[model samples]
Target: MSKHLLREISENIVKGDSIRTKQLVEQALEEFTPEVVIKEGLIPGMETVSARFQSCEFCLVDVVVAADAMQKGVQILKEKCRKEKAFAPKGRVVIGTVEGDIHDLGKNIVAVTLEGAGYEVVDLGVDVSPTQFVKAIAKFQPDLVCISALLTVTMLRMEDVIEAIKEAGLREQVKIIVGGAPVTQSFADKIGADAYVEYGTNVVYKADELLKKKGRRVALIQLPSILKEKHQEIFRKLFDFTPTFLDQNNRVILQGEELPECCRECREWNYEHNAEKTVVYSCPGGLSIIEARIEGDSIKLGKIICGPFLVETPGKVCVCAPGAKKVSSLELEKIAIFTQMIAEQIQIESREKLLQVQLEDQREILIRALKFQEELKNALNEARYRSLQSQVNPHFLFNSLNSLARLAMLEEAEKTEKFAYALSRILRYILRNIKSTVRIAEEIEIIRDYLFIQQVRFTDRLSVHLRIDEHIYDGLMPCMVLQPLVENAVVHGLEPLEREGMLEVSGERKGELVFFEIKDNGVGMSSDKLREISQLKISRSGRGHTTGLGLFNVHQRLQHYFGSNSGLEIQSQQNKGTSVKVFFPYIPQ
Candidate 1:
């Protein structure tokens, strides 16, 4: 029983049960040296469990439970190992479920197996967002970025995270391994992911392959075998570096280190002095080189050699030097294609970043619009606020005018018929303009009738004039926009003062927006009043006869038609006249 318990404790440590592992290790230590227990019982037990798990002899839970037991046993020996700290991690890896995915069983299993293999595993929990993955990459700067996604929908999001890395130009820095139920080797290829493993157990081999390639590439580049231990400044510069090459007859003849003859030819006419080895390389197009060689080690081609040559046949390697190792031209082409793929990946990542920013901006704008809309809805719900059409008190205007006409008839007033004619025209425009939208000309005509009626009512006290630019009458506007402003002008500007007042109405098209202005030289509003009225959320308050709904309601209607920027602007003082300028986006017919 004790031997079995000790064996179980060792398995748990290998499986990453840091919690239960210590307990079992301590229990095992009561009977043996912490070191002896770890060697004879713990290590061997974990090896057995790992084989069983990998070979399908043990199920996932079986492995996990055994790992938990093993962790407890390792803890008992940890104090002794600390004094003598001898074991080295097999490898280190950082793993996570990709952005927008929550499934993690596969990832967890892989983490366990990697731990069992003596690797230090950083298992980031599920549903990791792209930003989180990027931050983790930046933080740990791990040997690999292992991403898992269960759903096809979520798997695609991993492409975005990869793009983020590419944009930062970190694609070549860390290897990327992807896996999930929906993921395939093709998907991995399509996204430029380094490797794709289908099963958790398979990840062990995949990691080994990836790490080996990484090491070989580093060795080929003649850099440090352990890339992770390089100086931070070197890594920073390395990440930013890109390599370009020259090819001969569809063969990669020269890596970036050597200058191609084509480049020297282009520079032959120029006046730059330099002494360096010359070689051949492909430029932007088929083959023409520009620019002097930059100072640095050409990562692939060891030393700087300069010259140009052509390949005799396909699949032939361009010999930079007779004895140097030759690289397959096809392989070089794949590398070049990979560079372009990296650039495109970067562009995609930038777009996603921009999209995220736009969404945030739109959300803020929508929130403000909703607040303004709520305020307008509340103002429109008032009991006394009548529709603009009904607010003019048409019955009162007609009855008063009729009584005056009867008296004028008895007295034979000179313009009695003309006065009645103007009133009829005004009422016709008001009753007929029902559609929410109408041509600018139709709206202006409505204003014309309203002004004519105002002139008749206060012929001597009010002087109304309209001067609309011909270009302004070609667009469309909300129906009745002009009439209400005219009403407000006559009622508030002219009626409030005994002196004669002048009201001018005009409009013009400015780019994609239509601008309307109503100028009144009547008792202008106080600064406080103007400020309150200019605010979109202020309630409309005035006497029953002077219900403050006219200007307020017009403001709301303009906003409803064209958005918040469509509201009125009052330029006024207590005595000076007020000028209300309204702007609406012109929807061209």
Candidate 2:
């Protein structure tokens, strides 16, 4: 009848029916204890919901609704227990997401699961910095602290939290657990966490296991010679009897041959080789006494035979023999329990060592991967920069050849020779500097050569002005940054105007940055064209008819070298003028 009521309560919680769950808890209180209701009813229901959520049978909204029901049910039980003075928390847990991470769904779920397991949980919510976690540790004094992060960027803060706790001298007081989407077991180990759980439901069991195994008391005994002088004190504390060893043939090796009459008789019987063929045996008074106990005698014997048990460290086999005093059943039970705890502790230590080795192997692999990724990124950037440089060089050469051909056709030999000389200088500059950056003075010399060629082509229709700050002559910039913008102004802005067009190039140093401006009083762009160019969506009507490719190429290279802050800014008014400003970091030569 009690089982049926508990099942109904569990089903209601799963259904997220809060009213029904509260009523069931109140009703169950009359029959079952609060501990029984929590363990059997609420916890089991939550476990089922968590399993469903992990399997994708339930979504976040469904889990939230179910958690609401669970919370309501727990609150009613807490109130009831408080009035009756029966509330006893299983353990205390502190949980939060690390600094810079605002994602908290996973952290919240784990916190609720710990609460459902009867732990007193203190939830420090999302974006909890390292200092906050250390402060909470001092205030809460929890058995476990859980750190969570969903992003790779924020996941590193878990290590900071751990180091803070260590610095605060609170590391030993609590066990730390870390988890999130980007978190792995190897990462947790690297950060010195106590345990890492991939799933929320597993947090409950792992927390319980860690708390139980940590700081446990066990009796340790040295081996090989069980009668060693150092072990004498431990033996005396655990047993009244002086222990003895037996070989595989069941021959008794007494502590000393100080013979009691019973031990002499027992050794004689064993010398006749009449002991039963078994792993362990209990000795009685002679062969007759052993047979009597096997036949259901309740007599207390003077000494009992125990063992064929194994001990770690230096391995050996040994049997135990009680002292001259009579052995009781309770004393035998104590001996059994003590040995068992030692065996369990050894197994736990062995598993931890194996896991540490695996974590180290994983850490090595991650380090190699990160190094390879950095190399690959550099290679891709170089390939992209070279590709952009290739496009600009060919386009400039074709236009210069066209200007030279027009002068040749007009039969002007002296002007043709001058144009050819300037073209040669520009070509020589581009060929020599295909790498990333060059001095501002060298770049300005190349720009002057380029503008001279354009001015010779346009003749009276083009006019030029230069305003350069002498202090900024040593600053560095990309190789061909100025040539493309100047070419655009001469070809699109000045060439289209019938009257004389003016082009101005200016440079100045502003704090850490060097600013260059190219202003032209000619045909400027419309709002649509300006917007299109700013977005790198230039139409065929723009300068060079290359669809903004040259501007885009220059912009990309600027950003690549000096980050996004150092790039082009363009302002233009149709039929009035256009001004293009370029920014570069002032790296002194």
| Index of the highest-TM-score prediction | 2
Q: Which window of 10 residues has the lowest lDDT sum in candidate 1?
A: 288-297
In order of appearance, the predictions have TM-scores of 0.31, 0.34
Model 2 per-residue lDDT at 110: 72
Candidate 2 ranges beyond 4 A from true positions: 1-414, 539-549
| Residue-pair clash count for candidate 1 | 28
Q: Model 1: per-residue lDDT, tens digit, 376-437?
A: 57777763466664747775676676677677777877577556655655555555654477
| Local accuracy by lDDT, each model | 0.59, 0.66
Angstrom error at residue 559, model 1: 2.0
Q: Which pairs of residues have clashing backbones in candidate 2?
A: 241-323
- The runs of at least 3 residues in candidate 1 whose Cα sits more than 4 Å from the true structure, single-residue gaps closed, are 1-414, 536-549
lDDT of 2: 0.66
lDDT of 2 by residue, 1-589 (tens): 8888889889988899989999998899899866667668876787789899999998545666677787677777656644554357777889998865666656766775676567887889887988788768766778899999865645777998999777666676689999987789999999999999887657888898887655231111111222233333344556543344332233443352233454444542332112331122334331211110010011111122333122221332123323333444455445544433432333344345435644664454345434544655798899899888886966687577767756775786876766676676666667677566889998888778788877887877788998999899988787888888988887788788888999999999987778999999989999998877754465322344332337766765675577524767789998888899998679998
